[model samples]
Target: MRRNWAARLRHVTIDGLRAVVLENERLRVTVVPGKGGDVVEFLHKPTDTDFVWLSPQGLRDPRDHLQGAADDVAQFIDHYEGGWQEIFPSGGAPSEYRGARLAQHGEVSGLPWEYDVVVDSEQEVAVRLRVRTRRLPYRLEKTFRLRSGTAALEIEGRATNDADLPLHAMWGQHIVYGAPFLRPGARIRLPEGVQVIPHETAINPPARRVRAGGPWRWPLVPADGGGQSDLSVVQEPGSPSDIVYLTGFDEGWYEILTDVGMRVEWDATLLPYLWMWQELGASTGYPWWGRAYTVGLEPFSSMPTDGLAAAVANGTALVLEPHETKVLRLRAEVLA
Candidate 1:
């Protein structure tokens, strides 16, 4: 029994899978190594709020999950439980890149990862998680660290190309917010001069608010109902499901302000785009069935979620030379 208090680390199991818990005075984070190293729980101790959303389907181990249907998207959606997922290689939809079949969000996010505790102390605790893509010739390693007396979680990652040839891929941090911290009247804050690009087509039809087609300024867009809709303010349930991309970042930081707030910062050079996905219960379509009420603030290296091939066609995909490595840094802090 290792009992200290300022910062601590523990290993446990969830649904017969390996899990790691890292905590301090202000936050508790639960990571399931077996499930794509997903950060399922990000709890703010002071507010008793969990910032990450939990989907209706909940977490299901892919190994034991029997696929009723065969489809490129079902592999990911069926097991998705609305936590933070690190999207790599391919994002959005399935695509074939250089003859290799890439599934939705790539192969790494659905596979198990190996973990090792690097630092264990009262002042700080850190663990490193690593995974290699089954199809792509790449390896990803990330370290999660928590310090005593701080409400911030720091993540440092590296993606390396293990093959002898150059590779093109898309990388993203899919972080979503919901429930206690994500209610009506909540506000989203971004740096000045940031612009929002609405999805090409309207989603959730009749309920959709922001008119399609906009390189609009932050927070406000021409509404479909003849007035301007405030994108900054979270609307009531049943609001349209919207997808927008934020660009022209003076810095790589965004804040969600409510009774309990959260600030997320990342390396802007590595991830130049931020994807805002709002599935606020208006999606009565396939998958959601109007059961979702969440917003995803994702920092991505590519745009529009059409998959890697589209990103390559648009010239937004990141290219890694043979044996090259890319480093990533990100942080999430609590604000009340």
Candidate 2:
């Protein structure tokens, strides 16, 4: 008899919440099925370092989850224990479309998604998670896979408009990086010819050093004191929050160089824009209280974080025809 040493899948509980974990020789991943199907942990075996950031709020048990609050943003932030989330139908602030109102960060991020183990083999293990929006007539399905002897995870997603009318929406991936893995000297590399502009709706003006609404080249940005801050390098967290939109990618790829490097490669045609969110202990509101420090390198199907309506008005929203489906693929790998 021979022993098999490939990837394996198992069910586990974290902080009293049901979760699924996948492990191999090189990596270990944990996904919470009930909590928006978020990937709560991504650990590199060699270094024993987890790349994913865990929110200070910690994991909230599904039993304790509150629903249907008057303030959607407050409700969303209350349960946001940082990790990777899939934003669909809409993004950013609350917006009205058709006759329905979409919540902040959309409906899926805080909703429970149905998950099933699709493959349980020695060579690879995969899981599929699906969810349907309450306000939008769309079904979202995502498949996550991890192969044996590799330090990478692949994600495939499909969004289908299940209604008779066309739908205008914003789709994005909210990936935030945090401490230990995110520190000074770490560098972020993106495709050349990229352009960026300061977010117009930034709440705190004093927290960020970059001038708002200014278009400039990638990586190198003009600082407050007329100096230049290299956007590629990770700096100490203490500054205020800043948001920016990135476009004009020569290629659709970005990498964060640290002790455990991470590279995200995607289809440029489907998600052509990138949203950079820097929260460096600047938020002094209810959720953050100026205690959170993280960076979000999000790839979006549209521009601006105002709302779906603004995206539609700017002609950046993706319009899906009746019964149409769009697919996207991306890979997150540990760089050698």
The 10-residue segment of model 2 with minimum total lDDT is: 202-211
Which residue pairs show collisions in model 1? none
Residue 140, candidate 1: C-alpha displacement in angstroms? 0.3
- Give each model a TM-score: 0.92, 0.89
lDDT per prediction?
0.85, 0.79
Candidate 2, residues 294-334: lDDT per residue as tens digits?
A: 88899998878877888888788999999999999989898
How much does candidate 1 score in TM-score? 0.92
Clashing pairs in 2: 207-240
Worst 10 residues of 1 by lDDT: 202-211
Candidate whose TM-score is highest: 1
User: Residue 325 deviation, candidate 2, in Å?
Assistant: 0.8
Candidate closest to the true structure, highest lDDT: 1
